[model samples]
Target: MSKNLADLNSLEERISALEKIAENFKKRAAEIDEKGEFVYENIADLKNCGYTVLTIPKVFGGKETSLYDYIRLQEVIAQGDGATALSIGWHMGVVRNMYENKWNPKVLAAVYEDLHAGALINAAATEPQTGSPTRGGKPQTKAEKIGDKWVINGHKSFTTMSVVLDYFVVSASIKDSEEIGNFLIRKEKKGIRIEETWDSIALKGTGSHDVYFENVEVEQEDYVETLGGAKRVNPWLLHIPACYLGIAGAAQKEAVLFAKNYAPNSITGTISELPSVRTKIGELELKMLQAKYFLYSVSKKWDETKEEERELLLPQLSAAKLVVTNTAIEVVDLAMRIVGARSLSAKSPLQRYYRDVRAGLHNPPMDDMTIGQLANFSLNKY
Candidate 1:
C-alpha cells in the first residue's frame, strides 16, 4: 500500500529515511543507463522519494525544507545520474522562485499541489541568441498583448526537461512597452512546438531542445511576473548550483572509489598507496569539501534569510556555482588520472563525468563573468 506522505507522523524523519533510498538511487543512477540516455525514467520514483516536493514551502504544499537538506538531497540525486540530476535541478530550484512570485493564488496552489503529487517542472528562459538566461539579456522571444490574451512568439533553447515539465516559465518581451515578463506556458497549448534540437557533447540525454512558439496565445492572468528591466533576485533563474553540486558530489564519490581500488602493478600495490596519487586525491578532497560546504551553506541561507539578506549573497552564490562546477571537473580529472587510460574508455564513467562537470562552468553566469564580477567588486571596495 502506498503511504500518503502527508500522513507521515514526522516529516523530517521520513525525509531522512528517504535520503537512504536517494543514496541507492545515486549509485544506481549511471548503472541504470549505461548508454547515458536522458529521458529520465527514474523521475517518477524521485517524486515518490519526496525529492520534487522537498524544495517547496509547507505553506504551499511544499516541505519548505531547510537549505542544507535541499543541497544534500540534490547531491544525492545527482550522484545517481548526472544527466538526470542536472535535468531536474532547474525545475526543482525554480519552485523557490515560483513561491516568491506574485502568481495568482489558485495557480500557485495548483502548481505546488501537483509538486506534492509528484510532478516536475522546467523553466524556459534561455534563447538561441542570448544563451543561458543567467547572463542577463533582452530576450528575442516576444509576447504581444492581443485583446484578452497574449500572443507569444519566439524560440527557447536549452529547455531542460521540456517533455516532462508540467509547464514552462517562458520569458518574453512585452510588445509596445518594451517590458520583459515571464509567463506560464503549458505544453497542451496550441501553436507551441517542441523541437528536438539538443545537440550537445555533454548532458546529451537532458533533451534540452529548442522550443518554438508561433502565436501561442496565453491568458493575461497567467503571466507570472514582469522581469521589468533588470531588478534584483531574477526569479526565472535559480538553478545551476544544484546541478553542479550533484556532479561535484558524484565526482568526489568516484574519487573515493578510485582511491580505494586503484592498485598499480608498478609499485606492486595500489596506486593509491603512492604519495603522488594520494596528494592529487588530497587536493581534490579538499576542494570538494570546500565546494560542498559552500553550496549547502548558501542554499540554507537562501531558505532562511529574508529577501533583503539574499541580495548581499548573490556574489557568494555566483562564487559557489563557479567553484563547485570547476571543482567537479578538477576532481573527476584527478580520479581519471588515478585510473589512467582505463578511465578513457566509452565504457568508463570518467569520460562522461568529465564532460558533464565542465557543463557547469559553461552555463549561467559564465566563469569568466563571475571572475569579472568578483574583480569589479573588489576594485570598487575602498
Candidate 2:
C-alpha cells in the first residue's frame, strides 16, 4: 500500500468498532426527531474512533485519504447504517474542498486540530428560495465584506448534522462583488443560530435543519472558494455519490433477505419463490452492481492520473454521480415494492432508504441540470 492508503486503513478499525456500538441504536434512530433532540453516543463514539479528522492533508497531521479510500470507507459504513453515513458525509465533503483549494498552511493546521479535537464539520448550502445548489445550479446566500471580516447573513436549510457540527461551510454570494464564496462559519460564533426545522419523512436522524446567520462574522482567511475564482476541480465531491450507493447496496441486500423470509398472506412459500419478486430483485441487483463499478472506476481514474489529466475526467465523474444516484433510487424503490405495504411502515428499513436516497436527486447540480449540461456539451458536437 502507498503511504496515504496505509495511513487511512488505521481509521477503519476505529470506525468499525464504533459501527458495532451504533448497531444498538438502529431501532432508536427513527424515534429521534428534530435537529437538537437527536444526539447519540454512537456519534460521539465516532469521535473517539478517530473519525472526525481523516480528511486533512498530511502537513496538518491528517491522513488525507485518497478519493478511492474515502469513498470506500463511506460505502462500508453506510451499508451498516444510512443515517450515520448521511450525517458524516458533509464533513468528508468539506475536508475534500480544503484539499482541492490547497488551503493555506495555517488553515489546514487549524482544521486538523479541530477535527482531532472531535469537532464535526458540515456544509450549509441550500436556502429556502435558492432551491439547492444541486438543483438551482448556483449559490444564493450573501457574504458582505465589512471591516476586517466578512459578515454573512442568510438562511440555509437541509443542513445535515447541524446539531453536532462545530463548523459550517456556508455558501453565500459576495455582498457587493456579485460573486460566490463559501464562508466557514463556526458554530460558536455570536450571530449564528440553528433552528430545529429538519422534521422529515426519512433519514430522520441526519439532523438536517434550517440555519440562520444574522451576521455571522469570519476572517478573510476562513473563506474557501468553491466557485467563480481559483476553484479546484475537486474529484472529492464524488463522496456524495458514495453515500447514496451505500444506501442502495444496503437496501438491495436487505430486500433479498426479506424476500427469503417473507410469507405472503395467501402463498404458503417464501416471497423469494415468487416469480415477480425474483424479477424485481434481479433488476435491483443489476443496477446496484453497475452503480458500484461506476463509482469505483471514476475514483480510480483520477487516482491514477497526472495533475494534467484531471480536466479530462470531470465529465465522466459528473456522469457517474448522475447515474449512480438515479440508479440507487430506482433500486431501493424496487426493494420497497418487494416488501409491499409492510415497507411503508415507520419501522421498515426500506422507508428510510426510499426517502434518504431522494436527497440524491435534489443534491447539488441537480440531476436534471446535470443532464441538461451533458446534453449541451454532447449535442453541440453533432
Q: Pick the candidate with the highest lDDT.
A: 2
Q: Model 1 compared with the native: what TM-score?
A: 0.88
* Candidate 2 steric clashes: 6
In model 1, pairs of residues that clash are 26-80, 29-80, 56-64, 263-270, 264-271
lDDT of 2 by residue, 286-325 (tens): 8888998999999988889998878767667788889988
TM-score of each: 0.88, 0.86
User: How does candidate 2 fare on TM-score?
Assistant: 0.86
Local distance difference test scores for all models: 0.72, 0.75
lDDT of 2: 0.75
Model 2 misses residue 317 by how many Å?
1.6
For residues 1-382, write the lDDT of model 1, one tens digit per residue.
2243434445465556555555665565555445545546567666665566667877875666555655565666666666777776777778876876667888888878777766777778888898767677789999998899989999998888887777888999888877889888877899878888777878776878888989998887778788865456542233566666666666666666877776666667676777887887788778778877877777767767887767766677777778777777777887787777878887777777788778877777788887887887788775
* Model 2 lDDT, residue 65, Cα: 73
